[model samples]
Target chain A: MLELTKEPFFGFSLCMFSYIIGIKINQKTKSALANPMIIAAIIIIAVLAVFKIPLENFMIGADFVAMFLAPATAALAVSMYRQFDVIKKNWLPIVVGCVVGAVSAVVSIVVLCKFLNMPQDITASLVPKSITTAIASKLSEQLGGIVPITLAAVLVTGIFGAISSPYLIKLFKIDNPIASGLAIGASCHALGTSKAIEIGEIEGTLSGIAVGLCGLVTVFIAIFL
Target chain B: MKLFKKTLILFVVCFISDIIAYFLPFPFPGSVLAMIITFLLLLSGLVKVRQIEPVSDFLVKNMAFVFLPSTVSIVSYLDVFQSILWQFLLICIVTTFITFVCTAYSVKLTVYLINKRKEKTENA
Candidate 1:
């Protein structure tokens, strides 16, 4: 087993396999609720368990893909730059909407935790739930929150925002792309931004900008509250 | 010459901001600093938007793949997570629903308020 693990290519193959299988399952499901990542995670876990492959060993390969997070997040600036005109015109409303969205998310989570009498660590993990997983996980750890729980929260938030945002926009008659994007990005972070991109270029750009802005805002808010 | 100068400035801004953030004793990570620095440079007209485009685009396009490492880490800590699995699931579902409802409502309210204000101004 150790020798098999030492095979340098094994980890890479498994990561690729997980992503491919996950994408395939996602395409076949066509259900908003059925996230490819969640499905892929389950599949990967099952395979690992059956093969008795240690999670640590699998991580050796997976980490390579994860290292791209910094660059990927930085890339959001492109979309943000493209939408600078829209941002310049409606800066006030955009900023206000994001603040409202961020505050609402954080407050709702804290209130829910209090109502449920959840443990402190869990509550802390959830405080940064509106951010992307990479940032949220670090925030959770720093705040002494449960990192796993935070990751799950970020995933669910992103997927939920992605699926429901369109319906909500239509229902509310949100004509402005900037507003729509801000709402999605503020609440769901990166996952929501991906969905925003699918909606249109304007929506994508605004959401990308909002994700970064909201992350920064949430970090400041987290410190005070 | 112009493009090289712009890229150099952007890199310097990013690096300096990150370094400053590291020593700030702040709770937030250094990336936030880099973002602020970049935003300020753009807003101040010190750094050309076109110059930062390449680096920024690279970051956003592959954002999903970035979370792979941590998700894998989650797999290793399954036993720890198992104990709180139900709690975690509940939190995700509930919080997500709450965020959606709040965000939708807020957007609706903002639109309504803005429209009303416009109407009042027009009438007056």
Candidate 2:
């Protein structure tokens, strides 16, 4: 049984199987906290521990799936293109909102990191927390940060954003759909967009567009960092 | 055949972006560079949306699954994370809240200012 771990198929099958289970739980619960990635991560980790499987052995096949991340990131262009009309009409607000959001996210993280005396790698990992996971993970790698920590930070930030955005909107008295959606995407990425969709169609569309815009703006700011 | 062909185009774009990034002085992300190039290609009509639509849509939809293994691998770094768990949460929660508020208000303010300017021009 332990020997099976050596085959790439073992890890590949494990990841796929766990993800399906995770998706089922997500659907059954219909709760934001039941995120498929989070559930899958917990299940896989538990299985690996129980089986005494080494992380590297599982990584053999896992790396194959990770390879798709690049093309997937590229695929985002298609979605952005899909939103070309909305982007054109509200170009000024979308661009400005994302820029401000990205700047604030980075600046606040830096300031807190400095105040907390956090290590450089952790700080770097936390810096891209607000961007989508694919971009955040890659940016974290570019900055010499720990990729896993960055992934964790991104997930937590997303869940928080999804759960809190509705209340945040009300608290801030944000009446505009575009503004609410842009804020959610900037602060939370896809997870918040899911909630934004529930708010209204216009908000959902704007949120979706904001994810791409905020990602691009964050990457641009990372150059200066 | 169609999905394969679309995936090939995206991969080719990614491959070219990697080379471009390798030569740049800054540590630009190859993935992001690929994204920009793809977006530009789409905008310029060099690549039609349909040609890559199916594969791109599939990739986007299943993105979380692709990252699952890495997210699970977080267990390996548990010790590092353990020490900074509170700190990590603090930063994420505080920064995320601040980012949302700032972005929301700025967008509202910009839209308001734009509308006000338009109204003034209409009055004139």
DockQ of each: 0.36, 0.88
Task: Give the DockQ-based CAPRI class for model 2.
Answer: high
Candidate 2 lDDT score at position A95: 91
C-alpha RMSD between model 2 and the true structure:
1.1
lDDT tens digits, residues B1-124, model 1?
7556645555565567557866777576555555666666677787666776655554555455556556656765667667767776676666665665565566657767888999999999
Per-model TM-score of chain B = 0.78, 0.96
Give one digit per residue, the lDDT tens place, for model 1 in A1-225.
565864646766776677677778778887756665666667667877898887777777776766555434444444556668877876766777777777877888888888878879879988998886656766787788867667877877777678778887887677777677777888788778778989998788778777777777777888777
Quote model 2's TM-score.
0.98
TM-score list, all predictions: 0.78, 0.98
Worst-scoring 10-residue span by lDDT in model 2 chain B: B67-76
User: Which tens-of-lDDT digit does each residue in B1-124 have in candidate 2?
Assistant: 8878988999999999999999999888899999999999999999999999989998999999889878988887989988998999999999999999999999999999999999999999
Q: Lowest summed-lDDT stretch of 10 residues in model 1 chain B?
A: B56-65
Over the stretch A40-83, how does candidate 2's per-residue lDDT look in tens digits?
A: 88988998889889998999988888999999999999989988
Give the CA lDDT, 0 to 100, for residue A158 in model 2: 87
CA displacement after TM-score superposition, residue A93 of candidate 1 (Å): 1.6
